[model samples]
Structure formats: structure tokens, C-alpha cells
Target: MFSEQFNVRFYETDALAHVSNTVVAGWFESGREPIFKLFSPNLDLRNWPLILASYKIDFHLQIFYGKPVEVRTYVSRIGNSSFETYQEIWQQNQKVASGNTTLVRFDFSSNKAVPIEAEIKSQLQEHFYPQQESAK
Candidate 1:
């Protein structure tokens, strides 16, 4: 798993004095930076295009200003041209939010989605999370 920390600044708080909904989304996106680095140390957007297809987040608790938030990310799944990222936000050792994002590898020149490269796939495999079996 990859982790990053962020402090809840006053500007990130909503009128209710808690971190805003949209700000939480930004935190989840930030969680992907390290995972992206695994594929290309210096990701060149023009050459290797990636597009976010969708994301889902469940808020478990409120995150307040001045508190430190930790975001943990992992490669949850991989496909030919798309990959899934799972992330959790922890504040004071408690899980406050968790989510997943789907990103598709794209070819800007061809104006279409492209298959994930072999090298990238190999690196991503190292970070895949173990799948959990569903309860009957």
C-alpha cells in the first residue's frame, strides 16, 4: 500500500467546520500519485494518457480542520486498459472514508482507450490488493 498525509486546513473546511465533500475527492486523487509513479517515474501526460472513468466513496466519519488525514492507496484490480485503485482516509487512527477509482489507459493520438503496457502491468501487479470473498 502507498500512503500520504494531509492536514485539514481551514480553507478546506466547509461552513459546517468539517472537510468538504469535494475536498475529500481531491484527497483520494492525491492518493493515486504514488501509484502512478510506479508505472512511470516521470509520467508524461502527453505520451501516456490516463482518464478517470469513475469513483465511489463512503464517508465513515467527519474530518475536521487542523487534524491530520492519512490516505492509503492500493491497486485493487487490473485489466487490459483499465485499473482500479482503492483508498482509505484515516484520521487519528480511525477510518473516516474509503473509496475506489477506475482509470483507463488512453491514446490521445488515436483518440481511444489503449491496452495497458506490459511493463506497467507488471509493476502494478506488485501493488494489487488481495480480493475479499463475499459472505454467503
Candidate 2:
């Protein structure tokens, strides 16, 4: 798994003083940066190869501002033309939220999904979710 820590900014909080639900999505995407670099070295939007198919988030606890949060990311599934990312947000050593996102390799010109390259698939395998940890 790959992870990153982020210091919560004041503006990210909601009226209730917890990090806004909408902000979690952005944080999850930030955790995916390492994986994104595998597909797009410079992260150029013009030639972006992946497209989001769907995503789901579950909150386990509230995430307050003024503290740092860590996002852990793992590749849960990899298919011929798509892959799924599983991520979790932790604060104060407790899991606050988790999410999963499905993204497909696409051919923008044709507006169709395409098979991922063999080398890329091999690289993705290196980031698979550990079976033992999944039990937690």
C-alpha cells in the first residue's frame, strides 16, 4: 500500500467542524498520485488515460480539523481495461473513512475503454492490497 499524510486546512471543515464529506474525495485522489504517475508520468490532463467509472465512500468516524490525516491506498482489483482502488483515511490512529474507486483505461479519441499495457499491469500488481491486512 501507498500512503500520504495531509494537514487539514481550516477551510476543509464543515458547519459541524468536521472535515467536510466532499473533501474526502479530494484527499483520496491525492493518495492516488503515485499510481497516477505510473500511467501518466507528468499527469498531463490532455493525454489522461484513465477515467473514473464509479466510487463509494463510507465514514466510520468524524475527522476534525487541526490534525493531520493519513490516506492509505491499495490496488484491490486490476482487469484488462480497468482497476479498482481501495483507500482509507486515518486520524488519531483510528480509521475515519474508507472508499473505493473504479477507473478504466480509455481511448479518448474513440471514446472507449482499452486494455491496459502489460508492463503497467505488472507495476500495478506490486501495489496490491495485502491479504493479511485486508482481514483488519
Candidate 3:
């Protein structure tokens, strides 16, 4: 799993004094930088190879300012042309939120999804997470 810490800024809070829901999304995206680097080592936007397919966040507790938030990201699943990242935000030793994001490897020139190459897939496996099996 990849972990990143960030200081909560006052502006990121809402009138209720909790971090805004929208802000958590940005944090999760930032936490994916490591995975992004695997796809684009130099992070060249002009030749970006991945596209965000979808994301979902579930809040467990209110996140407030004055504390650092740690985002833990894991490669939950890797498919032929896409991967899913499971992330969690923790503050003051408590989990504040958890999320999942799906990103597709794309060939922008052809506007189509491309299979993930073996070399890169091997790298991604280093941070893989064992997802729980569904109940019968």
C-alpha cells in the first residue's frame, strides 16, 4: 500500500467545521500519485495514458483541521485494461473516510482502452491488497 500525509487546511473545512466531502476526493486523487508515476514516470500531462473511470467515497467520521490526514492507497484489483485503487483517510488515529477508484489505461490517439503491459503490471502488484470475498 502507498501512504501519504497531508495537513488539513482551514479552507478545506465547511461551515460545520468538518472537512468538505469534495475535498476528500482531491486527497484520494493525490494519494494515487505513486500509481500515476508507474504509468507516466515523468507525469507528462500531454501524453497521459490513464483516465479515471469512477470513484466512490464513504465517510466514517468527521475530519477536522489541526491534524494531519494520512491517505493509504492499495491496488485492490488489476484487470487487462483497468485497475481499482482502494483508499482510506485517517486522522488522529481514526479512519475518517474510505474510497475506491477505477482507472483505465487508454490510448488517447485512438480513444480506446489498452491492456496493461506486463512490466507495469508487475510493478503494480507490489502494492496489491487482498480484497475480501463476498458472502454467499
| Candidate 2 error regions (>4 Å) | 132-136
Error of 3 at 113 (Å): 0.1
Q: What are the RMSDs of all candidates, in order?
A: 2.5, 2.2, 2.3
Give the per-residue lDDT of model 2 (tens digit) for 1-136: 8999999999999899899999999999999999999999999999999999999999999999999999999998999999999999999999999999999999999999999999999998888889734754
Candidate 2 overall lDDT versus native: 0.94
TM-score of 2: 0.95
Error of 1 at 104 (Å): 0.5
Highest-scoring model, lDDT:
2
Q: Each model's TM-score?
A: 0.90, 0.95, 0.95
lDDT minimum window of 10 residues, candidate 1: 127-136
Q: Give a tens-digit lDDT track for model 3, residues 30-124.
A: 99999999999999999999999999999999999989999999988889999999999999999999999999999999999999999999998
Question: Which is the winner by lDDT between candidate 1 and candidate 3?
Answer: 3
Candidate ranking (lDDT, best to worst)? 2, 3, 1
lDDT score of residue 7 within candidate 3: 98
Each candidate's lDDT (Cα)? 0.86, 0.94, 0.94
User: What is the alpha-carbon lDDT of model 3 when measured against the actual structure?
Assistant: 0.94
